[model samples]
Target: MTTSIRGTANADVLTRFRRSAHWKPLEYAFWCLPVLAYFAFPGNYLLLSQIAITGLFALSLDLIFGYAGVISLGHAAFFGVGAYTVGLMGSHGWSDPLLGLLLAALFAGIVGFLSSFLLLRGSDLSRLMVTLGVALMFFELANKLTRITGGVDGLPGITIGPILGVFDFDMFGRTGYIYSVVVLFVLFWLARRLVRSPFGQSLRGIRMNALRMPALGVPVNRRLVKIYTIGAAYAGAAGALLAQTNQFVSLDVLSFQRSADLLLILILGGAGHLYGGLIGAVVFVVLHDQLSDLNPQYWQFWLGLILVLLVLFARGGILGTAQQWIESRRQRTQARQRAGSTS
Candidate 1:
C-alpha cells in the first residue's frame, strides 16, 4: 500500500509537470507576430533579424538571472567566445552553419563551466566583479590579437556559406531573417521545456531560498553551475547566430555595453517569465531605432527616463504587471459571480 501511494504521488507530480509545460493559446499568438512581421515588413528584415538575435541573448540572461538567481555583468564573455568560434572557423574555410553553431556552443559551454566555479565562491557583488573582469579580459585579448581577431577593425573575411546548402544569404536579408527566426523558435521551445521540468522547479526553489534548498538534498552549487553553463551555451548560440547572419564578427560582441543593454532589455520586459526577454527585446530594439532616428544625440536620455519610470511604477515589469492585473480581474469576476449566486 505504501509503494502504491508513492507511485500515485509520482504520477500526480508528473501530470502537473506535463500540464505546466503545455502550450497556451497566448503562445500561439505570440509566435504569430514574427510570422506576421515577415510578411508585413519586408524592408526591415535587417532590423527584425537584429531583434531576434537580441531576444535570444536576453533569453539567455533570463535563464541565469531570472531562473537561477545568478547575477552576471560579463555574460558577453561567452557570447564573444561563440562569435569568435564561428568567425575563426569561417576564416579557415569551415563555413557550415550548423557545425559552427555546435562548436560555438561547445566552446562557450566549456568556458561557462570552468568560470562557474568562480561564481560559486563569491557573493553577488564579487560575482559581478568577476564576471566583468572576465569580459574585460576577453575584450583586451581580442583587441591585442590583431592577427586572429582583426582587432578594432573587426574580424573580416568571415564567409558563411548557404545554410544547409539550400538557402543562401542574400543582399536583402530574407534568408538571414528567416534563419534567425527559425533558430530562435527552436531554442525558445527547448528553453520553455527546460524551465518547466523538475530541474527547473529546483532552480525556482534555489532562487527563492538558496539556503533552505540544500536541506532538501538539492545540490545548489551544482544546479547553479549547470544553469550557468546552459545559459552560456545559449548566449554562445545567439552570438553564433549573429555572426552567421552578418557574416562578420567584431570586438563589440564582447563589450560591456552590450551586456548592460541586455540587462536593460530584461528590466523593461520583466524577468522570470520565459517571454519577458523576447517582449523586452522587441520594445528595446523598436524604441531604439525610432528614438535614434528621431534624435541621434540624446536618445539615450529618453530611454533612461523610460527605464526610470518603469522601475518606479511597474515593479514586476510589463508582462509581470499584466499577468497580475489579469489574475486580479479574474478573481474579482469570480467573487462577483459568487455573490450573485448567494443573492
Candidate 2:
C-alpha cells in the first residue's frame, strides 16, 4: 500500500510537470525579447532602461492593488526609501552595488511590514488617504533632513561601485540598461511564479471576495500584510536600481505625482494581470516621449484623450483586450473545426 501510494504521488508530480511544460517555449520567447531589443536598438538603451524601471515599479503596485485588492496611493514611499538608502550608503563610502540593493530592499520591507497594520483597518478610500499621508510625511521628513538627504538640491555625489566588482555604469547607459533588464527579468520571473502559486491564488480569491475568504479559512489580514511587504520590497529594489544606475537621489522620488503616475500606468496596462504593468509602462513612456516631442505644451491634453478612449472602450487595457480578442478567434476556429469534423 505504501509503495502504491508513493507511485501515485510520483505520477501526479510528473503529470503536473508535463502540463506546465507546454508554456516553456512561450516563457523563453518572452524573456528573450529584451535581449533581442538590446542588440537591435543600441542607441535607445537609456530610454529602455527607464522603461524597465518604470515597469518594475508598476509591477510592485500590481502585487498589492491588483492581487490583494489593497488600494494605495502612496506606493512611492517605499521607492523613495530604497533610493535614499542606496544614496546614503554610497555617500558614506559603502558603495557596493549589490549589497546596497539588498539593504535597500530589506529596509523597505521593514517599513512596509510596519505600515501594513495601518492599512488593515481602513476602507479603500481611507487606505488611499492613509497611504498618501504616509508618503507625504516621508517626503517632508526627507526634505527637513537636509544634511543627509541634500534637501532641495537633491542628494549629490553618490558613487556606486562596479556591479559584482565588474561592469561599471558608463555615461551612455549601456551597462545600466543591461543591468536593469536582467534585474527586471529575474524579478518578473519570480513574480510570475508567485502569482501562479497557491499563495497567489489565495490573494486573488481575497481580492474577488474578502468576506468569503475568511469563511474558507484564509487568514485575510496576514495575507494582505505579506503581499504588501513583498510589493514594497520589489518597489525598493526598483528604486535602488534607479539610484544606482543614475547615482543620485531626489525628493521627487517620494512625490505624490510619482504615485499617481504609477497608478495611471497600471490602469492603462490593465490591473490583475502580470504583464499589464510592463505593457502599460512601455505604452505610457513611449507615448509621453513622442507626444512631448511633438507638442511640449499640450502633450497632457493628448495623453488625457488617449486615456479616456482607453478606459471607455478597452476596459481591460491592452493585454486584456488582446487576450479577449485572441480567445474569441480561437473559440471560433475550434467551433469551425468541430463543425467540419461532424459534417
Per-residue C-alpha lDDT of model 2 across residues 195-267, encoded as one tens digit per residue: 7766887999999999999998999999999999999999999999999998999999999999999999998
TM-score of structure candidate 2: 0.92
**Top-TM-score candidate index:** 1
- Model 1 over residues 1-343: C-alpha lDDT tens digits? 9999999999999999999888999999999999999999999999999999999999999999999888888989999999999999999999999899999989999999999999999888999999999999999999999999999999989989898998898988899999989989999999999999989999999999999999999999999999999999999999999999888999999999999998888878989997999999999999899999999999999988888898778888888889999999999999999999999
Clashing pairs in 1: none
lDDT of 2 at 24: 66
Instruction: Compute the lDDT for candidate 2.
Output: 0.91
Candidate 2 Cα misplacement greater than 4 A, ranges = 1-24, 338-343
Using lDDT, give the best candidate's number: 1
My TM-score estimates for the predictions, one after another, are 0.96, 0.92
What stretches of model 1 exceed 4 Å from their correct place? 1-11
| Candidate 1: Cα lDDT at 209 | 94
